[model samples]
Each structure stands twice: as structure tokens, then as C-alpha cells.
Target: MKLLKERIMRDGKCFEGGILKVDSFINHQMDPILMKSIAVEFVRRFASTDINKIITIEASGIAPAIMTGYLLELPVVFAKKKKPVTMENMLTTTVYSFTKNRNYDICVSKDFLRKGDHVLFIDDFLANGNAAKGIIDLVNQAGATLAGMGFIIEKAFQHGGEYLRNAGVRVESLAIIDSLDNCEIKIR
Candidate 1:
């Protein structure tokens, strides 16, 4: 987690509208080694949980979720933003992306996620937490138990993490940023 925080400080960019761009090493062009470490940390944090599957929303969350699932020996299921024609009887949820300033209908096939599954939701960033909330809604709709939620970076100022925790969900974030004011990122 220390390394991750350091990396964020070194390479992360602060933009207007409270955005922290980490594409250099995270969202866009990924760092395998760093991702591996993140996966390891997630696994370590949830080692005691009975995690049957890993769930993440498509685009950025895939990398860390797959890595964690691979390390945990579990199947990784990602919610697709665009529904394919082949996908039938899909479980769907609507999520609003704060950064994108829009809503997306994310779906996953019923075959991948099922009842009696202990799921761990993973994501690259937790801004408004709508994406993670949508994933949790899918898990709930499927009657799956949400074991926990993991994040590579969390914007503490947004209070999404607190919202989930207040709702009795176990949330873990590697790097928590307090603010992005004046083109500077402050870690909590």
C-alpha cells in the first residue's frame, strides 16, 4: 500500500472536476508488477473470507480483478457496459460514472454469477461509488453474499467508501486521497 501511495504521488495527475488521472500506470497503460502487488494485497486482506468469485465493472477494473482472481484461484466476472446479442437472461444494473458524467447499464450473464456465491468486488477507483454500488446490486439480485469490496484507490472526499461502510459493507482501499484541490492530491 505504501508503494501504491508513492506511485500515485509520483505519477498521478490532478485535473479539474476532482479527477485523479492514473492512466500512466493504472487505468490505461497498466503496470503488471504493480497490479500483481495490488492483487496480492487484496488477497491478503480478504484471505479469511469465503470468496467464490470476483466481480468488477468493465474498462478499468478488469486488470486488478483478474489478477486478484488468478491469485485467489477464483473465477473473475466483469460487468459489461454494452450488452452483447448472445447475452441472455442477463443480470443488469445501472451505474452512474461521476467522471464520465453519465449513467451506464452494466450487465453480466446469469451463468457466471449465481446464488450461494461469496463475491468480492474490485475496482480501480472509487469516486462516487455508483459503479461498485451497481455491482453490489447485481450480487444482491443474484442472492449472492458480498464478502467485501476492494479498491486500488479511493477518493475519501467523495465519501463513497464511507457510504458503503455505513451500510455495513466491508471496504478496503490501498490508497485514500482526501482532496484534489488546487491541482494537488492530498492523501488521507
Candidate 2:
């Protein structure tokens, strides 16, 4: 993940209030080569897990999740921020967005997620673990086993990674930010 760390240092923007904006390459305007490399790394990290499906929250998480799913040759399912009218038999949960500073009701159809399936969750960033918790809730409701979680960038200064790891969940992050203080990016 050294390449990712270097890219973050070069292109990532650090703002006050512990925000690291990686829109230039990671999120908003994606770099496909880097994304593929990240996906390859995730596949390598979770290769031994019993994963049958890949899950992620919509929008920002979609790119990395899809890339990972493609690399693993697994079906990817993303939870919709707003439940569509046609969605039925869906499992829903509330997740607080760290960047948007709002709560979102994320939902996914039970048809895609079901019992006896092991799943890997992938996302662009892990800030406070709210979205991860929400995915865990949905997976539990579906009786699906969470094989592991992968994140492109993890704010290690936050509690998300620690909380998930302490809870006995396998979490892998490509680039971990030690601190984003005074508009400086510190990678761990």
C-alpha cells in the first residue's frame, strides 16, 4: 500500500476538523489504475475468507467496492441511501455520515443478501464506523456472515478501526491516516 500512501500525501487535501479530502483521485474523480491496485490488495488481504458477496454503501463507497468485487469475481451489492419505491423485502438501517454530518437510511433488498452467504464489505473510507455498523446490522438481519471489511483509507485518528477490530471483526485498510491536524496529512 505504499503507492496509495504516497498518492495520499501528494494529492490528498487536509482541512480543519480532521477532514482529509481525497476527491482528486480517490473519491470524486477516481484514478482507475490506483483503484485497481487497491482492489488487488483487498483481494489479497481477504483471499482466504469465505466471501460469496461484496457489500458497500452507495455513492463514495461504490467505486472501490465495485473494483474489489470485480477483482474477486463476486457479486457486489450497495445499500441505497434512499430506499427506492420498488425495493421490497429490504433490510434497512440508519447510518450517520461523518462528512455530510447527517443521518441516512440505508437499505438493500433481501433478495441480494440472504442467509448462508458470507460477505465482504468494502468502502472508500472509514471515519467513525457508522456505515460499517449499519452494514453489519443489515448483514445480521439477513442472517449473512460478515467475512471481513476493507477500506481504501482509514482515519486511524478516529475510533472506527479500533472499534471494529476490538469487536472481533477482520478489518483491512490500505492507507491509514495517523492525523490530519493543521491542514497536514500524516500517514501511519
Candidate 3:
């Protein structure tokens, strides 16, 4: 976690108030070594759980999720933000983005999940729980069990974590910030 905290302090930028941009490391251009370490830690954190598949959303979440899946030796599945017309036999879910402050849809193929499989959801941030809800919906539609939710950095000031935890979803975050102000990130 020290590595992540330090990386945030060094490279993260604040756009307005709540959004902390991590372009130098995690979100945009990823440090593969850092990502691998994070993925190893994720494996360590959820080693006991039976994780058959690693699921996440497109754009930002794909890198970490795929890395985690690689470390765990499991298959990785990502929800597509834009549904391709050529893609068939898929289950689609719509989720709102609290970061961009809009609604968008993400798609996943139906053939990925089995009724008894355990899925671990991964994402870069959990701001308002909209993305999490969409992934959870996909899990339900496939009749697969939700094993857990993993995040690299979370906005603790937001209610997303609380909402997901209250709903009986196990959420794990590597680094949680209690607050952010004047381009400064504070950890709880």
C-alpha cells in the first residue's frame, strides 16, 4: 500500500474536487511492475476464496483485472462500455458513472459464466457504486456467485463502499482516501 500511496502523492492530479487523476500510473498509462505487485497482493488478500473468473469494466479496470486474473491463473472477463453489433450471445447491463456524472452501458458475453462459478469483480475506483451494481447484475444474470469486489484506490469519502458492503458484497481496497483537497490526497 505504501507504493500506491506514494504514487498517488507523486503523480495524481485533481481536476475539480473529487476526481483524482492517476494517469501516470494506474488509470491511464499503467506501470506493469506496480500492477503486477497489486495483482499479487490481491491474490494474497483473496487466496482463500474460490475465484473462477475475474470480472471488471472497460477502459480503466481492464488492466488490473487482467493482471489479477493472470496471477490467480483464472480467466478474465470485462464489460464492454459500447456494445459491438457483431458480438452476439451476450448479457448487457447499464450503469451510471458518478465520476463522469452520466449513464452508460457495459456488455458481457453470456457464455463466460456458469451457474456455480465464483466471480471476483475488480475496478480501479468505486466512487458511487454504479459500476459495481452493473457487474453484480451481470453476475446475477449468469446465476454465478459473487465472490468479492476488489479496488486499487477507493474514495472513502464516497458512500459506494458502504452501500456495497451493506448489500453483503465483500469489498477490498488497497488504498482508501478519507478526503482530497487542493490537489492533496489524504488517507484514512
Global lDDT of each candidate? 0.92, 0.92, 0.88
Task: State candidate 3's TM-score.
Answer: 0.95
* Superior by TM-score: candidate 1 or candidate 3: 1
RMSD of 2: 0.9
Q: For candidate 1, give the lDDT.
A: 0.92
lDDT of 2 by residue, 1-188 (tens): 99999999899988889988899998799999999999999999998898999999888888888999888789999999998987678899999877788898999999999999899999999889999999999999999999999999999988899999999999999999988888889888
Candidate 1: worst-modelled 10 consecutive residues by lDDT: 95-104
Residue-wise C-alpha lDDT for candidate 3, range 84-173, written one tens digit per residue: 889998888888877577889888888886689899999999878889999899889989999999999989888899999999999999
lDDT score of residue 81 within candidate 3: 92
**Model with the higher TM-score, candidate 2 or 3:** 2
Off by over 4 Å in 2: none
- Quote the lDDT for 186 in model 1: 96
For residues 74-171, could you state the per-residue lDDT of candidate 1 as single tens digits? Answer: 99998999999987999988888777779889999989889999999999998778987898899988989999999999999999998999999999
Candidate 3, superposed: residue stretches over 4 Å from native: none
- What residue runs in model 1 are displaced by over 4 Å at the alpha carbon? none
Q: What TM-score, to 2 decimals, does candidate 1 have?
A: 0.98
RMSD of each: 0.8, 0.9, 1.2
